[model samples]
Target: MAKILVVDDEAHIRELIRLYLVDEGFEVIEKANGEDALAYAENQSVDLAIIDIMMPKLDGWDLCKELRELDEMPILMVTSKGEAQDKIKGFKLGTDDYLVKPFDPVELVLRVKALLKRYRIDASSLIKLGSIMLDRRTYQVIYKDGNQVTIPMKEFELLYKLGSYTNQLFTRDHLIEQIWGMDYEGDERTVDVHIKRLRERFAEFESDFKIVTIRGLGYRLEVYRD
Candidate 1:
């Protein structure tokens, strides 16, 4: 059973989430504050985390960042704030998914399952998208025509990440943290530059997949289906 850490300031909210998750055969650990949640994660094994934005000690934003830095476990942010900017902030902080308040418990469970599945796919060293295959182990892009291209380390990683979760949106901040390390001091435009290079290098593979810029957001890989 996968262990889930649920951090919410409201007792009822935590209970509601726990009841539903436990029903799905998941092990749930409840924390009323981000500090306690972070402490638990550091000392224990957690497969995923459900965080609330408004908490007494160390809000969900910081907690999400801390957990992401700790490992690649998926994070789901549940908050009453439904504003677009707030959602963007959560994504930038590395939350894998988000849920607004008054959300159906069923939907929450579905999102949890989806995130787990997505992460499982991401764990693989090889990602096959349409006609192209990304070999993470060798940092090579193998085409259907038997042509292979090896790109820079950063470019390969960025492409691998996007292709791993095709059609999923990724904010620049999140990509920077995942590809460049949290301690990277370069500008966010570094992602833009690398993305441009990837586009140019794989321009002919448009039929297989394309990296799209979601204005004001970031980027997503779109794989064409036959």
Candidate 2:
């Protein structure tokens, strides 16, 4: 069963979220303030977290920053502010998604469902392309006969995105936006560097998966036969 931690200052809202989450067959834990929520998030084995932005101890943004340092579990922020800046801040902090106050319980559950679906796919730990396997969680890629290739996280994120969306042409900006996020302040050419590194690793490991650059566009992952 998935464990969900809900943090909301208002007792009613917390209860409402907890009820729906529990009814959805998830194990739900509730906290009333960001302080306690941060503590549990830092120490406990929570699969997902829903934090209220406006809280007494620590605001949702601070809590999110602190928690993200320790865990990458999906975090859904609930706020009443309804500002684009606030939403951007949440996403920039690596939050999976955000919601505003006066939210529908069903919609909340739906977000949770969508988040969990992506989480499950990500947590699979194995990215299979024909006979090649890339494990993001373990940072390992093995050939069909079990040869190993080592790839770093940024490279892995890039390769994972490529292999996940095989044959889809993504420009440098698009790759930066999806892989790095909109608020990321980095050079667009960094994508080229990572791609160069990825190709080197793939060649050295003699893997059948290759990343191809689309001249005026960007790169993609295709089977060696492609």
Tell me the TM-score of each prediction against the true structure: 0.53, 0.52
Poorest 10 consecutive residues of model 2 by lDDT?
Answer: 121-130
Residue-wise lDDT of candidate 1 within 1-226, one digit each (tens)?
5788999999999999999999987889999999999999999978999999889989999999999999889999987854667898887777889998989999999999999888883332568878888888689988889898888999999999998798999999999999889999989999999999999988987887899999999999999963
- Distance from true position, residue 13, model 1, in Å? 0.6
lDDT of 2 by residue, 1-226 (tens): 4788898899999899988988977789899888898888777878888998888989888888887777778899997855667887788788998888889999999999899888883333467876778877677777789987786888888888888788888899999998899998989899999999888876754456678878998887777642
- Backbone clash pairs for candidate 2 read none
Model 1 earns a TM-score of 0.53
Looking at candidate 1, the ten consecutive residues that score lowest on lDDT are 120-129
Point to the candidate with the largest lDDT.
1
Q: In model 2, where do residues sit more than 4 Å from their true spots?
A: 121-226
Which prediction has the highest TM-score against the true structure? 1
TM-score of 2: 0.52
